[model samples]
Target: MKEKIKKNKERGIITMEKQRLRKNKGITLIALVITIIVLLILAGVSIAMLTGNNGILSQAQNAKKRTDIASEKEAVSLAYTTAYAKNNGEGKVTYSQMQDALDDNGTNAEASGNIIVYFPDSERYYTVKDGVVEGPFEEKPETELSAVEMFENGQNCDKQDGTCTNETHLHIGDYVNYEEPTSGEPCVIGPSQTGVENYQVYSLENNDLNWRVLGIEEENGEKRLKLVADSPVKRTGVRETEEGETITEGVGPYFDIYGAEGYLYAPDAMDAISQIFKNDDAYEARSMNINDINQALGKTTDEQIKEKNFLTMQGFIQYKESYGPFEGQWTPEDWLKQNRPTSIVSGEVSAYAYLIDNGSLPSELSGIATTVENERLRSMLFDNVEPETGKAYWLASRGVYALSGDSYASFGSGVVTSEDGITVAGVGDYAFNSNGYEFGRSGYAAVRPVVILNSDVLIEKIEDQPDSWQ
Candidate 1:
């Protein structure tokens, strides 16, 4: 009996021990699962922090870049300030001076002509002119625009709907506005019938729509903009005499009395140009000259004109050599200084031929060819004419022409006139009572003003019906 009791006790102990082992194993499994879940959560958070957008790594890198750029800009500013101070408050700083200033600021830079380049980046540079710093230079466009292109694109035309009728591109023959001159008032010499006192009058009412682009001219080794008026500032014409005969008035008799020499340097031409501006050194306004006409027509050549039958086309063969300073001849070195005639009565056939070829000639003024359809061309060529009156416009030029095929030389004033509803580009003159014989050329004209702009002149665009340029 004792032995059986002992065996039962041992079996019970074994069963209890097995239950304890099972409970401990379950607790260990639960603990293992919780540890694995916590590890996975931690790993996911670490990846997001390191590799996702706006991660710590990215933020750190961005911070570094920003710091570097700021440092660079600060260095540039410091260098510029130092250089400017060294320049005695002058706006300009030399390339060498800028380099020295940069060195002082602990920034290495190189000098290239008027440009100073940052040693670290070639794209960064600054332009300097005569010891003046123009400021930081950005990378220029791969295709730099030409001067003509700037004029075309920078025009002040409204493009709200992307359609512009009035030329968006400001070019030759386009109207440009400017401030009226406050001083050096221009004298308008009217017809003799208006009296000499009235001839010296100045009216500001006639200046509207007067300014137009003449074309480009070379001044001081740089291309400059030239502006001309649509009509003359003065009126010069013939007055009926007591005997019912017409005679040239205003500066016409000067051509007869003083000859071509005096007319070339006549006060009418010189004073008219000078009095339009306020005597500003930056602006040079003058009377339109023959050379201006020639230049606008692409400086045509004699061969080209002959090939096109310009003289035959215009029925001006007899007066072929009536205009002076033909193509490839002497041009005035200093128009303001030249006191003598630079050219004799020679033919500039190219100008007329170009008009015919381009169909720029007026239907009534030009020969049996197409009329000028382009408004710009019309403004350029015939805008100065008072076609109804057959009055010509004076040019700052002079010539000598024959009087009715006579041996006696007669003086002529350069003019762009209309005769019998035809355009006449030649000289003007008046009848002289020389040796009691009435023998001289007769013409009536006025003065058209021109302005040569300074190289640095700014063309401002206005929003009015006729845009202004200053």
Candidate 2:
């Protein structure tokens, strides 16, 4: 019996040991499964972090690129406007001209930078690198007066025996010298009439005609005359009267008079006057008076025209007292009073201040950076970025006519948070683009900077806000 009891106990101990071993094995299997799952989760997270839209590396690259492009654009714009202002009305400077300037000055493209000026009339943009011109924007059509017309305009002339002849008829007061004469007297031709103040003379040498006045000389209280032609000149009639009277009838009777050689017709001045009146009236219409040209250029004086510049949002506000009225709204008698800087987003305090100071935001600000359809975004950006506080806000909703033409519309509400947890709201889209606005050619485009502010401060502002405001 004693032996049987000991054996039973040993059997119990063995069974217990086996049970313990089985439990350990089960625990090990469970731990292995959990470890596999945890590793899978970690792998998934790693992939998402590297490939997500907001991945750190990608965002950093985009930000860097944006900043670089903005800087480049700003440099280009400053150079162009400065160059234009310096060289206005000197005739359009082709790209090659700019390139030559840069090349002569030894400008460094990578460091000193370059500019490209665009002349729309020439349909070309001149590329200026390191202050040197590179390329013309595009070829332009050559438009010039024809040779015949130019010649007829008195570009051609010839002299024979102290007489000047041109394809176009001659008028009195026209000065002529014989090509053969080394230093002889100049022939002064008298008009058909004394009162004939102006006349058109055709150049027979170059087949051109020009207008001239009669050369009047008073010697001892007696008026003397000179003729473009010397001796008995034969006159041809290009145009005759109805009665077949030669238009040149009373023009001249060439002779050496008062020691001055040439033909003089003091008594027939009235005939010259009559012939001028008989000519077609088209010449009167084709002429451009000085007043017309001045009018076409808008204002002649620099003081009459308004000046503009691209400034930062803060800078615009600082100078708001000087801006003009809103575009298409009203003109100020004192332009300084009426002009004001405005943002796409209404109620942007900074923009209001800027408009009040600068008069107007750049026209390019409306659509140069982005399409005109996104004006609303621009407006929203302005409204959210508050001044002094330096915070930006964004809105959740969209509105109608959010963009006017190519300008962005200001709408919605949101705040931009700073890295240090400070929050200011009501910024606009064009705030950053405005900085870049003046840096490029007239039609050049730029990207706006995304608003950045303190995130912690943003959350706090939202939490502290009333439910109604939200």
Candidate 3:
């Protein structure tokens, strides 16, 4: 019985030991789970602090940017003050002075015109007006301004009344109403005259001239729009006699009057144009040259006649027979060869005739207009105008023409367009007919002014008109 009691005590001791071991294991498992949860929570918080819009790193970067901007602003301010003192306390500083002051501070800056200055360090732009600095903000790219854009933006009209269309598109040949300013210097015509002291001062202010778009052309590395008046503005001879008759007395032999140093783009005409634009330098006014007229007529220079066969013996014979009752003997072939096609517009055939034939003329000059388009172009350029009013309009160009059969040539002569045709005027032509020949037969012409708008000049509005050429 004592041996059984001892065995029971032993069994009880083993059960207690097993229970203690299980409790310790449970405690260890619980501690391990708590430690993992704590680590995960700390990791999430650390991630949140390091990233996103309001993170610690973002705040630090923003603060650094702000500091840099402040430093740049201080530098610009110091430069301005230095420049102001150097200018004897003047309210404004010149562009060079401002640049020099900025350079002295070891700060690099860029300028746009005489206005805005850009700082590269802070990527900020500032305006220096009257020697005062005004900005420390990020710079925005400037929008490119154009004539069509300005018109479509309704800059000149009251949009509330719907007098303007925001989608209006501008094109060549469209009419525009540009009023000459009323307060500028008066335009002086022929300020200095030879043999006589005669000049005219014209005030074109407040005049809304109906100008037609000739097209866009590039002048001096800038694009500009060209416009021509619909009619002659004034009637005057290129070189007028005392009695108001046109003459070419002192013009050098050959056509020297319409060249670079001649009547082409006359200085008097250009000076008058400049005076008209004294209040607004963006607009340039001048007399239309021959090439300008050719462009308006949808023709190009050096293309009016074929270069190879234009003044050939066969072509000359055909031209004379087609357009003349020839009484003068035809010149020798050697003479014809020596004085071949000499000018941009070559051939005995009229420009109108060449256009009608589509620049393809047969040896017999029997080519007919294949389409009515040529006739229309001819009428638009030369015909369909009042004979008296549209008689002679001067084109600032030199012209050369030689008759095949006679000692006839017109050189250094003013090119004029008239109801008769485009011919050399001011300098006379030496021509002989079946009856007789005439020499130095000069005529008078009026001025047709053209206006050129610089690329940067913004137009406020354009009048709506049907395209007549179409």
**Candidate 3 clashes between residue pairs 3 or more apart in a chain or in different chains:** 254-411, 255-411, 255-412, 256-412
Better of 1 and 3 by lDDT: 1
Candidate 2 lDDT, tens digit per residue, 415-456? 122223212222222211211121111111111111111100
Quick one: ranking by TM-score, best first? 1, 3, 2
- Deviation (Å) of 114 in candidate 3: 17
Query: What C-alpha lDDT values do all the predictions have?
Result: 0.48, 0.27, 0.46
Best of the candidates, lDDT: 1
Q: lDDT of candidate 3 vs native?
A: 0.46
Instruction: List the RMSD of every prediction in angstroms.
Output: 16.0, 36.5, 15.9
lDDT of 3 by residue, 1-470 (tens): 88888888887787778888988998998888887777777778768987998888998899998797777767767777787798677434534566778898787886443345688756798765555667764764453445533433433444423233454434443456555556764444442211112333344542334565556665554456666655545322235445967553322111111222222224356335434632342446776565565554444534432331233323332322233333332321212344432322223433222222333435354342222233323332344232233434545444333445644332322334333322222222122222222222222334456777645444543654442211
RMSD of 1: 16.0
True lDDT of residue 322, candidate 1: 46
lDDT tens per residue, model 1, 144-178: 33333335463444442223334335555655554
Question: TM-score of each candidate?
Answer: 0.48, 0.18, 0.46
Candidate 1 lDDT score at position 84: 73
Error of 1 at 289 (Å): 1.6
Please report how far candidate 2 places residue 315 from its true position, in Å: 77
Question: Which candidate tops TM-score?
Answer: 1
